[model samples]
Target: MNTRALSSIFTAELRLLVRNTAVAVSALLMPLVIGGMFVVSGLQQAPAAGWGFYVALMLLTVFGMSGCIAAAGTLTYRRDELYLKRLRCSEASDATILAGVLAPVVVVTVVQCLLMVVVTAVAAESLPANPVLLVAVIVFGTVCSVGLGMATTGFASSGEQAQTVATPVFFVLIGTAIWAATDLAEGLSTVQMLSPGGAVVQLTQLAYTGAPLSETASGALPALGGLVAWAVLGAGAAKRYFRWEPRH
Candidate 1:
C-alpha cells in the first residue's frame, strides 16, 4: 500500500463525510440524543449494567449501523458518479483505495465511541469491567459493519437503490438486537447468540456486568466466534462482488 496515497484519500473522504449534514447528524448527534433519553428514563439509577448496556447499545447502533450505512452510501454514490472508477486508474493499489475509503468511517466510529464512554462515565459512573475486552469487541464490530457495508454496495446499481438495499439490512440488525435484549424462546435465544449483532450485544451485556473473561468465557467465546464468522463472511462477499464501476 502507498502510505501517502492512502493518507491523501483518507483526508479527502473524511472532509467530505464531515461536511454532509445527514451523516453529521446521524453519526455524531443521534447517539447523544438516544443517550440522553436513556438517562432521562432512569438508567442512571441502575447498576453498571444500566449505563453500560445503554452505552454499548448506542455505540453499536451509531458506530456500527450508522457508520456502515454511511460507508455503503458513499461507495455507491462514488460508483454512480464514476469516482471509484477514476480512482482505480490512479497509482493506488486496490487495497489502498479500499483502506482509504474505510478509514474515515472507522475514525468517526472511534471518536463517537470515546465520546459516549465519557458521557456514560460522567452521568452514570459506568465503566467497562474489562477495558481490553471492550476494545476488542469494538474493533470486531467495526470491521464486521464495514465489511457488510461494502458487500451490500454490490447489490445497488445507483445511490437511490442503495438506500433500498441497505434499509432491510439495517432493520434486520435492529430487530435482532431488540430480540436479543428481551426474554425469548430457548431456541430463538440460541439463534440470536449465533448472529453477529446479537453476539455483540451479548458480549456488551457481559462486559457491562463487570464479569471477568475467565468467568464469561463460555458465553463470550461463542459471541466472539460469531462476530469473527460474520467478519470473514462479509469480507469474502465484498471481495467477490464489490464493484468499482457503475453497473449498466
Candidate 2:
C-alpha cells in the first residue's frame, strides 16, 4: 500500500464527498432522517425483537444507500471524470487506489452505525446482549456492502446510472432483511439464513436477544458464513469487471 498516495487520495475524496450533494445526502442525511422517525415512533416502548428490527433496518438503509449505492456512484463519477485513470497511472497499486477511493464511504458508514447504536441504546434504555458480536457483525456487513458497491460499478456507465443499477441489489438486501425478521417455515428459514441480508438480520437479532455464543453457534455460524460468501463474491465480481476508465 502506498501510504502517502492513499492519504492524498483519501483527503481529496473527502473534500469531493462534501461538495457532492447527492452522495452527501445519501451518506449522511437519509439515515439520520429515517432513524429519527424510528425513535419518534415509540422505539422506547418496543420489545427486544422490535429493537432488533430497528437495528437491522438502520443497517440496511445506511449500508445500501451509503456503502453500496453511494460508493458505486462515487466510483463511477471519478472514472467518468478521468480521476481514476489518473490515479491508475500513479505509483499507487490498484488495491491502494481503490481503498483510498472508498475509504471515506466506509468511514462515514461506520460512524453512522456507531451513532445509530448509541441512539438506539439510549432510546430503548438497554444495551445489546452481545456487544462484541454486534460489533463483529457490523464490521462484516460494512465489508459486504462496500464489496457489493465495487461490483455495482461494473454495471454503471455514469454516476446516475450507478444508482439505477444498484437499486435492485439494494432492494433485494432490504427485502431479505425484512423477510428474516418475520416468522418463516423451516425450509425458508434455511434459505434466509444463507442470504446476505437475512444473515445480517439473524445475527443482529441474536446479538440483541442475549443468546449465548455457545448456544447460538449453530445458527450464527451459518449466517456468518453466508456474509463471508457474499463478501467474497462481490470482491470477485469487482476484480473481474471494475473499470478505471468510463465506457463510451
Candidate 3:
C-alpha cells in the first residue's frame, strides 16, 4: 500500500543487484554453464526428451537455483551490512521493506525465463508445445525459489557464508525435483509422484500435452502439496526465525 516506499525500495534493490556482477549473472549464468556442460558431454544430443527439452528444462533449473541464491544471498548481505536492522527504523513497514527487496529479484527471474523461452525456440528449433505450462512452471518455480531464499537468510550468519549454507538445500530440493522428472516419465508410481521435481515436470508435461488435470492427480496433488507446504513452511520459518541484524 505504501507505493512511494515500495518504489523507492525497489529502485535501490535494482541498483544494488545489478552492481554486483556475480549476483546479477547468477540467474542467467548458472543455467548456461550447466547447459554448456551437457553440450560438451554430448548428452544434449542424446535421445532423452531431445536437446530442446533438455535445454529448456535445464534453463528453468538454473533459474530456480539462481533465484534462490540471490534471494538468500542478498538478504544475508544486507543483514551483514546492517541494512535490514536500519530499515526497521524507517517509516516503511516490515512487509513493505521485504516486498521492495524481493520485487526486483522477481522481475529479473521473469525476464530470465522469458529469455530462456526465446533462446530455446531459436537455438534449439524447438517449440514449447504448451506455452502456458512454461509460464506456469517458471512462475511457480520463482515463487518457490524466492520463498526458499527468504527462509535461507533466517539462518545465515553472514553473506560470505550463505552460499555454503544454502547450497545443500538448493541442490537437494532441485536434485529431488530432477529425479522425479526423469524417473516418473515412464509411469506414475506412488513414490515417483512424491518427488517435487517429478511433480513439476509432470505438471509441465501435462500442460505441454494439453492433457486434462484429472490424469495428473498422482503427481500433481502431492507435488502441489509439496510446493505449497514448502511455501508455507518457508514463509513461516522466515517470520519465526529471521533476524534483522548480523548474528555476530
**Highest TM-score, which number?**
2
Residue 161, candidate 3: alpha-carbon lDDT: 69
Instruction: List, residue by residue over 210-237, the lDDT tens digit for candidate 2.
Output: 7777887777788888887887787777
Is 1 or 2 the stronger prediction by TM-score? 2
lDDT of each: 0.71, 0.80, 0.65
Error of 1 at 143 (Å): 0.8
- What range of 10 consecutive residues in model 3 has the weakest lDDT sum? 47-56
lDDT by residue (170-235, candidate 1, tens digit) is 566656776776742232265787776577677777777777878977877777788778778868
Superposed Cα deviation of residue 35, candidate 3 (Å):
4.2
Q: Which runs in model 3 stand beyond 4 Å of their true positions? A: 35-56, 210-222
Stretch of 10 with least lDDT, candidate 1? 181-190
Clash pairs of candidate 2? none
C-alpha lDDT of residue 89 in model 3: 92
RMSD of each: 2.6, 2.0, 3.0
Candidates ranked by TM-score, best first? 2, 1, 3
